[model samples]
Target: MSEQPKTSAAPARLPGGNRRPAGGPPWANAGMPAEKSMTFWPSARRLIHRLRPYRMALLSVVALGVASVGLSVYVPKILGQATDIIFSGVIGRRLPTGSTQEQAVDGLRAAGNDNLADMLARMDVTPGAGVDFTALSTILAWAVVLFVLSSVLMWAQGWILAGVVQRSMYELRAEVEAKLHRLPLPYFDNQPRGELLSRVTNDIDNVAQTLQQTLSQLLTSLLTVIGVIVMMFWISPLLALIALIAVPLSMIVTQQIAKRSQKQFIAQWTHTGTLNAHIEEAFTGHELVKVFGRQKEVEATFAARNAALYDASFGAQFVSGIIMPSMFFIGNLSYVAVAVVGGLRITSGAMSLGDVQAFIQYSRQFTQPLTQVASMANLLQSGVASAERVFELLDAAEQSPEPAAREAAPTRGRVAFEGVDFRYQADTPLIEDLSLVAEPGQTVAIVGPTGAGKTTLVNLIMRFYELDGGRITLDGVDVTELRRDELRSKIGMVLQDAWLFGGTIRENIRYGRPDATEEEIRAAATATYVDRFVHSLPDGYDTVIDSEGGNVSAGEKQLITIARAFLADPALLILDEATSSVDTRTEVLVQQAMAALRTGRTSFVIAHRLSTIRDADLILVMEDGRIVEQGSHSQLLAAGGAYRRLYDAQFTSAAVDLDESGAAAVMAR
Candidate 1:
């Protein structure tokens, strides 16, 4: 008697106010943002801590990154020197009297570049003199080599960082998967499966993409900015001051735009999940939509969600889109400022023409990183948003801890509920002060109308939902005192909608008891009569079942499920409307197999058809969450109570719904 719902209605609204088709339960925040508020930095810190193990690899990546940026920055200076060599060649003049090599060495010393002066003196060129093409070509060659080395370092850094980011994502995904298993059922009840799937797949993927695309770029950009700033000052302090003015302005502009666009990015991420949730819901329930003729309404819902997604996406993209161009505009402005100022300095002989060119190049290099950061601003924000969602799932409270001193207890088929109280919601009580006991090997039949707490009782027995008060015990020991796995191992459940994963029929059955031998599997299948149809299929037990077991008939699926439960050979069995889907002939076979399986076990049978449980040792009839009648069939019928009325109603309804000829025969009888 598993309490898991066979079908649940779609939530009214997904996150971001994307509504499902109208007319359903209250809107759920399933795939939406967390109700429990969280800040950004805390989630970021958690992810950073997860990435701590690979810090050395990251450090190596940083070293490579810095080396790459340094080479890149140094190349422009070398190119500027090459430009100076070419300019001197075009001028082509001999030194005037008294302008000796000693004076050139003194000038270089004042410029703080004695090494360049030494190299120049070694070249033995008299100033002003004819072109030194050989020396000039050598400087240009060195520039090319430096450029090649810089590119190689950049490539190496990218490669190493890719591995680090991917490995961190792997560990992150594993932790989230493990956390899913540890989270309580109640947590899932309030969450959308689509949203959780998004966290594990899409959201984490966003984080990975951000790391791969942005992390190295961020490091390079920061280093480039600092390196370029230093080079600009070294070229000429006055021109560097002129270029530095834009730094504050660029930061101000970037901060303003990023602050606005970050909100849009958050909305973009939320709406993206909402849209995914809607698509998942619509597809999962597509058959229901067609049956109920809700295609138009479903489309309408989709259109609305798509529109919401588009708005968020457009806003985020448009706002972030401007950041690059805006930063470029500021960069170009600073370039103009440097050109006007450096040109005057070069004319005044306060700076060389080559120095002015390098200063202009340095100004561009400095702003390039700012431009990159602005472009990546939206990506980083989106990643941060996704990280928050993933962290929320990881931070969710896990199932209650087991007692430290507890040991495994023998489950000998005896079960009892002592004054149990439970409710799905705080305001709505489904079961109140319910008490019952099933002795070893007893068959307890619980019959009730839908929502009469019949399934809830089964849920309580399985400890799917914590009881608000009182306690449930197995073999005289409180079930909660035992480990959940240990307790559930003793109970086998078969529901109305038989659940089968995507695997071979034999594999699905083996899933019940992973250690079961082939012989044991065959024996269990034989007992459940599943072997009858199984052998007929071309692949026999090797036949693969689709997700939801759709490849097989419902009755056949149930039989296989029964075979699974039989293989487990649990001491307590729960048959939840097990025969409700089968034809009369198949029902007889299933009932026979169920009887055989329950021979030595305590069984709780929740059935819509009363005739199946006529021979049960005890029958408890419930209404309004309380047992109104308790006795065997004959005893309950003799009492002429609510159970009798229910029995008569079902009997009369079956008679009335018979075919015309059968009705006449019944009337005649």
Candidate 2:
């Protein structure tokens, strides 16, 4: 059956009419609200919860990070020891031969240079010795070993974190996939397809990247900052204090910039979803757009959405980009302060030259991590924004659950709608107190104008939407008591739109019943006349259908669907405008096949063509959700009511066209 017509004031609430409102882009629908301020912590916490299963791997990464950062922090101190050894040897070579180090210290003290004497006492030196290259070489060697070991541990940490992130993302993607299956039909009707696609593809990818890039680096940076601070204070407290002043300033900078950029990141992803929806719609309807001369309008809308996305992306990047430079400025100031203080301490002999040098290195190490942390703020914000979108999808309301104990479906199809009451919207009544029955082996044809709930009737029989009141039964058993899958397995349906997957023709036909033997497949194909055109092709049944099924004509596609339904051997069959796409000659053949298929099964056929249903056991004429007239075709035509008006209208138009053609031909002759 054709789709119900939509009104300009109200959205479509039934199948075929289940689309976002017209006259604007899908994102402009009232259902899709403006982008709100991101709830970063909640979304981030939920994202982190996805890693609960990887606790052991994450702990291993943490242990490696600690060892690596510890070794890295100590290496500079070891090198500082080597520096002291070299300096002490140079001084010792200038002293008198055989003079004790204690005697030199006393001599310096006697000259009233107490600070220099104290510095000399701190160093391990012999007054008469030359440079201690042996000790220096040992310290340098240890430093190299520590550096290499630290690097190995850091690499191992990164490797573990990468695995954990990927595995977590895999679980997340699986959950999203499963969640999509559970969402109700109405949810999809209100949502844009491309928006959902962006959430599944683009948003998940962004979240994965954020975790892969930031998790390891952020962990190591924070650990390095802690280790460096401890080493700095151990070497010289005064210089440590001088270096610590930059921490607050860096925090202030990060906090302020992140606040401004967080909203922009949210806007960026929201616009991305909207733009994706627009592109998907435009491409899917490209032929229609071109036929209507709306190519320029489509292009204009695309440009506007693209520009919005660009502006949002630019604003987010620009605001977050300020962080690194500001951090560098703060770090440089700390480095200078530490350097000047260390030099003065050395001149006063309050600190050893080696200790001062190690403290200076620690100061740089401290500031570098702070800078890195600041730089990563943008990635964290963007990722959290995307995570929030994914979370929303995962949290959408699901369809009603199945019963724990399911009733067995009936073997024979005897369907009845007893005092059924339903409506797409609470206020808009479509079907009220509707009652009907189709006995076993009977053919029931439903005829209706557009928006007359023809397709909605079949959809209800399939339990696509729940009734507002009353119940439907099959063979005197409530359909709700049976498992949906079990009930649906006994029925076969063919929709108006002939959907085919990208595969060989044989595979598409076998999709209806996977366990059907090859012989049975060919038999069903021949019965539906699909073999007529398929056999003419080079590959015959093996001919491949593209994603869009463009290689096959519409009639061929319809035939394949019919063959699929035929192969099911269903107890109940539903054909919704099944032959509307075929030409007159093909339609006649299809009608014969359908007649054979419906021989002993209860069938419900929804059709607009009145000529197709003249032989049906019963004809139901529906108008505005009510069965205004129903009986055998001859009886209804005899009464000259709704069914007679419809039948007359169709044949009258055909008769006029035929007479006009005849008159024109005679005049030309």
Best by lDDT: 2
Return the lDDT, model 1, position 22.
31
In the range 60-88, model 1's lDDT, one tens digit per residue, is 88898888889889888888777777665
Model 2, range 1-669, lDDT digits (tens) per residue?
576422222343332335444423324552132233447788889899999899999999999999999999999999888878888998898878888888998999999988788888877888879878888888999999999999999999999999999989998999999999877666666577898899999999999999999999899899999999899888888888889899988898899999899988988998899898999989998899999999999999989989989999999999999999999999999988988988878767787788888888888889888888888889999999999988888877777787666645447889999988877765678888889999999999999788788888888888877788889998887878776788789899998999999999999999999999999999999999998899898899999998678899988999999999999999999999999889999998889999999999999999999888889998888898888999999999999999888888898868988999999999999
Off by over 4 Å in 1: 1-27, 36-42, 93-128, 654-669
Q: Which window of ten consecutive residues has the lowest lDDT sum in model 1?
A: 2-11
- Determine the C-alpha RMSD for candidate 1 after optimal superposition of all C-alphas: 5.3
Q: Which pairs of residues collide in candidate 1?
A: 1-574, 93-128, 93-129, 94-128, 95-127, 95-128
* Candidate 1 CA-lDDT value: 0.81
- Evaluate candidate 2 by giving its C-alpha RMSD to the native, one decimal: 4.0
When summed lDDT is taken over every stretch of 10 residues in candidate 2, the lowest stretch is: 6-15
